[model samples]
Target: MSSTTQKCADMLCHRNGVLKCSRCKGADPETFYCSPECQKSDWRWHKKFCGKQAYVFDVELLGSSNPKITRKVAVPSWYTFKQFHFVLQYIFGPWQNCHLHTFSFLKELGNQRIRSDFSIRKEILLELCHEGDVEYVSQNWFDEREVKLSDVYEEDGRLRSKIMVNGNFAPLLYEYDFGDGWEHKITFVKSELARAARPLVKEAVGCGPVEDSGGIQGWNKVKEAFAATQPTTEQLERRQWAREVSGLEERYNPLAEPDVIVMNYEGRWENHEEGYREDERRRTAF
Candidate 1:
């Protein structure tokens, strides 16, 4: 019999469970189901976890001209690389997903220190092979949808801790928009108990760069134009371009604080508060 102190894992059912999931029997904070029917209904969400643990990560955007932009988030190990991509899109710039992306893993070879010259590396591409895409038959390349966070960070998210060198964990690199080269370093923080089905924002800092604002250099120019008291013709044109690309009616403020609440929600920023409230209600209901 399952624990009587806890309710069913199903969001819609709070009744005490009589049966536990065999697959996740030994998982910490194990899942329970009142019946096979309830378990079947919740399979869509539960399959992601199976029995894997959750992990917290510190994702920092690198090469940004602005102050260091970072986000601390909690995500389930079962989340696919594609799902993780969406999480990054939401937190960074609340970015519009208009470009290609890829996640790269760097491994240490001998005493090389895992710098850029490593002979061994793996890349997870946005697509394995599309109709018009060139074929990459090597094992090094994988489809984002086919890989999960757990597959990379094995041993229940302790892979980083084992590889820690000089008190620093090796970071997983993610690149978005090949042209602009929006690179981020994803470092493992710690393991966490499963709490929410959706990714949660633990912390956020600095606003993300506006889309189509070039790279760091271009973004700096946009900032300069907005900050100028007496604008030059080039500055005025740059400001207009920033506003037009970002769909902002007013001048773009690079230093504006990021809204964590809005970032956590999926839809438009206007309905973020309502979405947050609804999520809270559901969380507390059980």
Candidate 2:
């Protein structure tokens, strides 16, 4: 993929090189504007869902060598990206849940924009550039604890202006486990009324690679060991190691694909707390 980035989305500066960019708090997290003025001017249309809204994000693991990892999640507009991180842990079961990660809000670029309707026009300059093309500036990084999901959103529950003003909606870049180098592209798919206070996993595909299974490559080896009709000593050891850490030694399937679990917590809201308690009881049962 080319390393080129799109110019800011501000209409006034149609040809002006982008100085800075932010994601929209409105319906599209992929659209961005060049300046705050452009972002605010467009807010009239975006403000509709800025309050008490929720979003469904399509998250896919980037840079995976094999077994594409993806999930569709429903979370409240008020959740901090940090809270959503936990929800991912529940679904993917990252190794020991001990990993370092960061979220980048810059415009989605290159092949990462997989949506068929996704536009590359934002990356193009309609008129000859004149503003002495500003050098690409690095986006500011915030610790998970420092920002809430709503921090990037507007008061009405739209995405924060700072995140969307200077650029078009870009996927929320979440790279986890630096050692494993698992990069996830989190895109805001749609907005809706809040279902409940807790987060939900609407759909999931592909079991998350075992944590620290040597990133994608190691993960592949682990899979082969499990699928092996007659396993090698090394394969058996790796398989056993994964089982011990995940606490699924007894039922861990070497040849089985990850189960497809579709959970809508909103539908089971009344029973969720009890379910959690029961899960805790089982966790301690052993």
lDDT of 1 at 87: 73
Residue lDDT tens for model 2, 98-191: 5555455645445543222224423322111112121221224344545666666544433465456354454466656756667677787776
Count backbone clashes in candidate 1. 0
Estimate every model's Cα lDDT from 0 to 1: 0.66, 0.56
The TM-score measured for candidate 1 stands at: 0.64
Q: After superposing candidate 2 on the true structure, give the runs of residues whose Cα lies further than 4 Å from its correct spot.
A: 1-51, 109-139, 154-159, 165-167, 254-286
Angstrom error of the Cα, residue 39, model 2: value is 41
Q: How does each model score on TM-score?
A: 0.64, 0.59
For model 1, residues 165-218, the per-residue Cα lDDT tens digits are 565545577767767767777888887765456677878888788887787777
**What's the CA error at residue 141 for candidate 1, in Å?**
1.9
| Candidate 2 similarity to native, TM-score | 0.59
RMSD to native for every prediction? 9.8, 17.8
